[model samples]
Target: MRAPLPLDAVLGLASDLIRAPSQGGIDTPVAVLEVGARALGALGLAPRLLDDENGQPVALMAEIEGGKPGPTWVLNACIDTAPAGDRGAWSLDPFAGVVKDGWLWGRGSADSKIAVASFCHLAAELAKSKDSWHGKLIVLFDADEHTGRFGGIKRFIKERRDIGGVMVGYPENDIVNIGARGFWRAKIEVYGTAQHSGAVSPVPKNATVKLARLIQAIDAVTPPPPPEGAPFPLPPKLTVTGVEGGSGFAMVPNAASLNLDFRLTPAFQAPVAQKLIEGIVAKLDAEIPSERPTKIAALESWGAYKLPADSQLGTALVAGASLAAGRPVPGEVCGPSNIGNYLADLGIPATCGFGVTCKGVHGADERIEIASIPLVWDAYGHALEKLLIG
Candidate 1:
């Protein structure tokens, strides 16, 4: 039987990463990536940092090559984490890397830092027994993931072309995620006549009121259902994320804007959603004349994707998860768009989610269950063996 994963070492490394500040938009992630590089180096692998045009570290990569040639597999996880909100609400410091009650608590303990540690150790173990598997194993730690830039993964894909499949180390245990819902995001700006609040001679158009109407209209939209035989049915959804308008009480606001976030399914794609919103804006413009036509500026968008049940990546992952859990582990399509959606757009097969169980992600008091590490290690190891050894 294979030796058990280096649990203590993995936890220690995870704790070290957790102590580093890499909160998206708040802290620099390059520092955390440096820490990751050192950990990989400690595993007897030569890890290199990938930089963008600005010569800033965006990602870290370490490759373990087998003697025989076959498909290359990537193990990816983000080092950047969501901002620590309301530090006062936590029982301990969000960056303390506390291990208590069989849990590792920190800002990134559950989001993905732990996976970075786990993947590094797993790759090291595999390197020691390379004769058992063929092809190459790539361990990637990405930065700018939580910031929505995804500069790290984007740069990696743009520079390399031999990736066969990728497994994103997102926290979960019940299901092996096969796909994810896509998204169409935009910013709508509304214009109106500005005038003094006391002036009655020129009736001022209330931009806020118009924006409210638009919000109501969008809320009433019922997106089309998923494809007829979609194994994992995911419906499209729209939400008005933000609104900004009047500054003070005296003057009537001349401009206002609202952010629109629309989740997409295969049936309700980006184009269809965009056209629907355009039609709504036109209708609203004609009904209530504004100073300028309402403008919809497109933000980043990605298409939805779902892998077949028999897909090699998904099948192997499910089998591995089932073995680790001691029960049947189903393949699932996640509701939120993830890095897998980005890879899917490039026609690359990827498993979006599968890892240890965690709680309070992107929220206060985030922590990972320490006991779940062994099961996650086994699942990924078995899956890699199935894919590489075959």
Candidate 2:
């Protein structure tokens, strides 16, 4: 058997992972996976890499087998981070992976790679010691989470059915996140005919103007009523994220497009929201006839869910968090995350929201406090021990 990895080795691995430029669209998650595989193999565990249809490296699954019969517990963390915007604002190169002031500076430092490293470290240590645990320990490092497709988890679930519990290492400052808001994304496009500015002006039509009106009307649509038995305190909401139009400076643009992003309460289903959006677009189409016709396009839709606070997994996670934090941990649901949807749709009793306290996750100067890294590691170890091994 290999020796357990020391703290220095664990941090070193984390630092290396942070150094890898695994930003969402351009990230090579496989590079980070390779590092994890090396560390896991050194500790006698097996690591496997999985890819999506485009051969884009998506996730890593590492496993440690035990002889006893017990439920399998999955420890998952995303290996991708949002692109680093405006390098001038950062103290160090966003991909430099520098460590100073007891903090690790890099794109994936806090948003996720730290947790991935921590889980790998935990698995390596456990494997070395041959910890007399009963259940299987599965570590999943995913990509494409920041894009909100639940891509990696969705793929893993489809191929396997033995996952008994899941611990998502999202930054929650050790608090257990049992619920999250659901969301859907759509795009609306409008078409108009292009005519010379000198043409006779009987009825001038501008696609940009019509698109703006459609945006205003869609924004005015009332949100649906909350689900009858929903537990969360809020309702679904919508926001207009992007707009593009006008092809030339001299002539009125003949076409325009807008992106709609909606974050919904668990009460609403994706299909229902899609239908509602289609109806709104149909109404707009009727209102703005094709003197130049306009079209509404639905880009993508994802459902939302909220786990009851009283559920077994939810209560256990909270209890474990309180124990790890050495104080009472208050539970709340305020953010939109894919965790709830994954658990609800897959019928998996899972608890999420375990990681360091990080600000600027999807913003500039993104960093994870070096001090919080070890604390998060210890918290996850304690929580896993309590849930899977105890």
Please name the candidate that would achieve the greatest lDDT relative to the true structure: 1
lDDT of 2 at 73: 80
Q: Candidate 1 residues 1-390, lDDT tens each?
A: 457989999999999999998998888877798899999888899999988879888889998888788888999999999999899999899999999999999999988999999999998887887776678899999987988899899989987778889999999888899988899999999888888888878778888889989999998998777677766588998989999999888888888999999998877889988999999999999988987999999998999888877788889889999998899998888888999999999988999989888999999999999999999999999998888887
In model 1, how large is the Cα lDDT of residue 6?
Answer: 91
TM for candidate 1 is 0.97
- lDDT against the true structure, each candidate: 0.90, 0.73
Worst 10 residues of 1 by lDDT: 223-232
